[model samples]
Target chain A: MIEGHDLDYVVSGIQTLHRVSIRAEAGEIVCVLGPNGAGKSTLFRLLSGEIAPRAGKVTLLGHDVTTTPKDTLATMRAVMPQESVLSFPFTAFEVVMLGRTPHATAGETMADRAIARAAMAATDSLAYEDRTFSSLSGGERQRVTAARVLAQIWEGEEGRALLLDEPTSSLDLLHQHGLLETATTMAERGCAVVCILHDLNLAARYATRVVVLQEGRKVAEGTPREVLTRALLADVFEVDARIFVPEGTEIPVVVPRGPLSKTKPPRLATGALL
Target chain B: MTMAEAPTSRPTPRAVARPFAWATSRSFVLAAGCLVVALSVVLGCAVGAVHVPPLEVLQSMLGLETPHREMLMSIRFPRVALGLLVGSGLGLSGASLQGVFRNPIVDPGFLGISTGAVLFAVVAVVLGGHGAVSTMRTALGAPLLLSAAAFVGALVAMLSVRWLATVEGRLSLTALLLSGLAVNTVAGALTGVLLYAATDVQVVTVTFWTFGSLGGATWGTVLRVAPIFALGLVTLPRLGRSLDALVLGDAEAGHLGIPVERTKLLVIVVSALLVGAQVAVSGLVGFVGLVIPHVLRLWAGASHKTLLPASALFGAALVVLADTSARIVVKPAELPLGVITAALGAPFFLALLLKERRRLV
Candidate 1:
């Protein structure tokens, strides 16, 4: 379904993502895995039209979106940012209602609310529908934000895009897997879901194709078994990782090669990552 | 808090919220229209010593066959009309500025726009530039110079704020508000300095201008400020959706297909024109823009499509009603419109903030 001449994305003039180019086919979950500051978020912003490329073309659904209007850029493409904190307190239902912006007259068919409810239900956030969004926990907020993005896309509509910029960054393990499960479900529904992941294991498990970014460049692109090798992890990520292939599964299990150092350097204290 | 806690509350359910919303929407418009009509006639009846009945005031206002109505109609009707025009203009302009800034705390005056206008208008009045020694000095000169000085002052202030606020192709809220505060402080200092140097009569004239009055309201003032208000009224309603999107933040507004930069420009320009014309006539009347929107938003959700028009109407009604009370409260004597606005606005605003203590800063 993704049939654009420039299906690949080219990000230039940046530190690391200057020469990155990648493409994922229709109905596939494409995950980008890289170390911190690998510019995964930058690449996603370019694709989402939040940041303009210095010298590149981003085509979506066969249309040149290099300079497309934000409203018309991707009617079905939804971006769930890292965190959705509002200065004003808006209800969860109200926050989710923003996803219907692309739809005309803001019509609320039974099916639309059902999709929002279903997304929330999948994330175990159905109870949050009538609650103030500000009062939700971090993990619950992420789920609500994910539900909002799901609402952005028209159901059963082809050529829809889901751009997740580290949706599980602030989530617990359970919520993290739950979010990925929802993303996989969305891809099963024929969405071209692209997510940036900090966890290599997550990329290997759910991603049909894993694109690795070194600096601002695309280093490797292939299936979990093809790209998630020990040498590739060490060479690209500068950290050794062990790839395990269990029986009766095409996906490989990824474990970082380090002994998992917990001690912080004397000069720096362990702090929460922003 | 639900309506059960407040007996007088007119709470409309969500199922029938639409029609009640429509009625609340038109109530302000209807109130403003009625106020204008009633005040014009009441103003005609309010000559020096005698109290003209509403009917006699109307007859005199129309120039029908009446023996002594000529002086009342010719002299007082202009004052009343000017008051209405200035009041309506100020209220609407303040509403637009509040909407554009997306901050309920914003008023047209808070940005120092009115200070600039008042400064120039005061200077014009002090200098007696309308041929102070001219024959029709009292009636003609005030409106002419006041409106002119006001427009020029407003343009400069807005242009300065716009220049200060714009950085890297976007208006930074922090910078915009900070610059406004700075300019307001400076302009206020200058106005105070000017007040000290004025002659006794000039001081009184400028004092009235600062405090605000429709006593000097005139047809010529209306003619000058009318088109500005008309343009603001027309252009602001179309920006509702854009403003609604802006509440989500600039990036979000952009993502929603609204032309953010263009929308900001239009809002700033129209708001400036409204404030400029209003200040030229009535001087600086604070808090209507700030308070009115907060009031409406509590009732209506933060939807700009409903908020802007509703704020405009409610702002007009509030100001006009304030002006009416200013006229009749003291009976033979009159209070400056500013005093009335402040007296009414301050307590109400405080209560509003208190009621929503959870949301207050």
Candidate 2:
């Protein structure tokens, strides 16, 4: 079980997490969804021990480790940051083997290789295990990064817990769906998964539950049907939205509406990638 | 060379030895490095005003029968030994510094460690410890104060850089480069100040030191530098995996459970100690570390496990050959060792910068 008690994350002048609360039992895929500048990445950093929470408690399996040392915290969970600009030309397999660090003394063991290979296979990245990571495409790098996180989380009988910040950002359309499908499957098999996603369709499809954040605070969270609503989108995201249900699916499919229909939109910025 | 197979599935000959195997393509690199070091040792011994022969040089080196006792025994061996030691030391230090800094353009001089050594060496000579240039001057029964100062200076420079440019021990390249430039310029000015204030005799001695010669080579100097090289080579390989792991950036290295701060500190100190000792003895020979690693990387895949050792051997060869050429180029009146290194190094540096056109940030 992974649970947070009064977690708070702040960056620069912004509070990224404000008394955010959450819990994940034995088997569940809890996806966090938010718009740009919503502070999801900051929360992942705090949970991974990449950065310390301003005030709150984080406990896994009944042990308090909010202030645990980095290596110590690594033993309990694994996190994949948004950017993966590695400097050297490490092989894909060698890159994944880094997940074995916290375990120590497990290098080249049968168990280690099996778990690493399985993680790669799970994300369909096993075929390129021998290739240099630098030569991979953006989507391939995303899958490999996800595989590394999975390998780390499953290192021992600890049963694995994963925390990712926009892990699908660089992936292509097929890879995006493939990766989320695998992650959802793993969560069903009893891994506590917390993934930050920008795509509402993916969240609605794969998440057992959904978390909505605006600014730095948690605005809504419940079943996919309950959180993926037009009312919450406008109130929190400040954008008009519509919720659709496809046939027999209980999860709502979300689509956003523009402000142009109500009032003239603000001028566009030239430097923006969007 | 790019890996021919995956680390796991490759047979024992490749997989088990991936961390240690020397690639077939790099055999030339290995041989070129070896051949130069060998040629330098023989030629350096035979080509003085005394004009010893190649055979006699070999005999003396092998501890076999010798013709002239004093010429072959005392003078020649010490010079050859010192050349090999200082050469290899400078090379390894340069390679390790480049890896730690993670910038292809970086070399042993980046953190101002070598400049710091030079500054302290000048200070020691200027302060009138006339008998204490303490490096090769050990034959003259000096205090070794020069080397002592250089070591302290190198350590201080490395520590200052580590403290300022690293945020919680995660080195920021921008900060590191900026700090290196700042520290190098500052340390270099201190050297100039000392040189300006020195007496005529001190100035001459300092000039020769700055030129960096194996001419000052002696058994005692070899003794002082030997342990540092051994310590660095031995310790650096232990961090091969850590260094390789570090390429994934600090956050990734940390995720892999490496103590990033501690690893950076070790690399900096080891590089400083190694480079400072060589500079104290050889007088700031540049480019041995800078050019060799890149050249080797083009041949050997970017795995530090193999890269570190190969670079060390290659670096050792570069210095020994450059020092040898420096000795013979103006034999009766030797050119500065620094001059030879620059002649060899500058061209290579320009080429590397140009060829790395795409990788330039």
Candidate 3:
């Protein structure tokens, strides 16, 4: 389990998040949806222990995350940023092997290599293990990086959290669903999975629970059918949209009509590719 | 290099070598580098002012031949040992520093360690006169005052750059690199001022600070430098896995459970020590630290596990060969070791840049 209460973050004297309360339980997927500069990535950074909160309490696996050592916190949660840039020519397998760094005592053991290979297999990236990471395309690189994070938490205890920031932004439609399915599988296996996504339909289809944010405040929080209504869409995302459940589907599907006004063009690009 | 075939349902070579076999493709390249370095060291000891045959050199090394034992032991062997020590120190420091910075082109001197050491050494010569220097050398027997001052100067420069770059517990790479440049410029200016204030005889001693050579090698200098290099060797090779993780950005490395700040600090301190020690003995021999690692990375892969040790071996080889050429090229009057290194390394570096440019475009 991962929980944060009364979380407030200020960056460069601007309040990014104000009095936010968020939680992720085992065996569930919690998706965060927000517009540009809505503090989604900032929240992920706080949860990952990359940065400390100005005023808040963050607990991971029943321990105070702020006071816990980084190595101990690293064992409980894995983070996948938007992009990981490397200067050297390391192969995909070697990159994944680096995920075992915390567990490795002296050097890489045979068991570590096996776990890395298994994680690659889980991500469907085993075939390209020998290829250099820089030579791979965008989507392939994303899967390989996800494999690295998977290798990090592969053998952890229950309630380990996997946090992803814009994981499917660069992927195609099929790959988008495929990647989310992997997260759902992890959720089913008793891991707390939190994903920040821009696509509402993908969030509605995959998220067991959804939290909507606008201007750093939690606007609505509940199931997808409760939180993803037309009024919430119009008020939070500023879009004219129709929400309905199709014949064979159990989740809501949104069909956006257009922007509310021509002055405010639709913000389609998330700028998370870098 | 033939790519290992992907794992199949059947057993593979990687599986067979998983538990016991330590040799990979990178290890093969390292083994080859060790052979070349060993051969070069042996040949380097043979060709000096008096050309001892290679076989006779080997026989004397085993204590069988005593005719030229004094010449080999007293002069040539000490010089070769000094070259090996300084070369390996520079090479290993270069490789490890590049890993810490996550840049392929950076050398050990990127943090202002070399220039800082040179500046303090110049200060030792100019401010401390010939009488003072000789007195200290005779008392301590190894030029300890100059080297100790140089080490202190290097540590000061590195710490200043770190302090300037750090903000709110985070070290910015851009700030770190720029502060290094700033410190180097200041140290270089101070060195110039000291050179201007020196006497004529002191001027010659201070000039050697710029153009390095191995002509001044003695058993005393060799013994003094050995402990510093020994400490470096023990600490540096063990940093391979940390460096491998650090090649990814620091945030990524931290998420992977590495103590990013601690690892970065350790690498910076250790490499500065190694580079400072080399500068104290050899007077800023250039290009071996910068070029040897690049060439070795191209030959082997860029995994620090392989790249670090291989760089040390290849670095030792390159310096031995360069110093040999420096001693023999002009026949009696020796060229500066730094001149031969830059001349050889600059062309190779240009070729590497051209190759990389082609690949980039």
- Between prediction 1 and prediction 2, the one with superior TM-score is 2
**DockQ: the better of candidates 2 and 3:** 3
lDDT of 1 at B333: 87
* Candidate 2, superposed: residue stretches over 4 Å from native: A10-14, A63-76, A91-94, A100-121, A125-132, A188-190, A259-264, A267-274, B1-59, B68-72, B128-131, B134-144, B159-179, B356-361
Candidate 2: tens digits of C-alpha lDDT, residues B150-212: 777888887777677887656676677678888989988777788777767677666766667
CAPRI-style docking class of model 1 based on DockQ:
incorrect
The most accurate candidate by TM-score is 3
Query: For residues B1-361, what per-residue lDDT tens digits would candidate 1 score against the true structure?
Result: 2111121112322222345545444355446556655654465355444566667776776768776676665656666566555655665666566556655556667677888777777766655543461222362344555666777777678778768977885556667767888888888788788767666666666666678766666566667667778888888876776776666666666665667779888887777677767776676687777777776666655556666776666666666667767777777788888888888788876785565455433
Query: Which 10 consecutive residues of model 2 chain B have the lowest summed lDDT?
Result: B1-10
Put down candidate 3 lDDT per residue, B1-361, tens digits, no spaces: 1011112112322323234334447668788888988888888889977898888889888989667889999888888998998898889988988888676656546667788988887787667655675332331244566677777778788788778877786556667768889988999899988867876766666566578887778899889778888888888888888899888778778877778888888878877777777877777687687798787665566788888888888888888889998989998888988899889777876776575553333
| lDDT (Cα, tens digit) per residue for candidate 2, span A175-218 | 78777776666575667888898888888888888888778788
TM-score of 1: 0.78
Ranking 1 against 3 by DockQ, winner? 3
Indicate the worst ten consecutive residues by lDDT in candidate 3 chain A: A260-269
Residue pairs in candidate 1 whose N, alpha carbon or C atoms collide under 3 angstroms: A16-A215, A16-A216, A16-A217, A17-A216, A240-A257
Candidate 3 CAPRI level: acceptable
Between which residue pairs do clashes occur in model 3? Answer: none
Give the alpha-carbon lDDT of every model.
Answer: 0.68, 0.72, 0.80
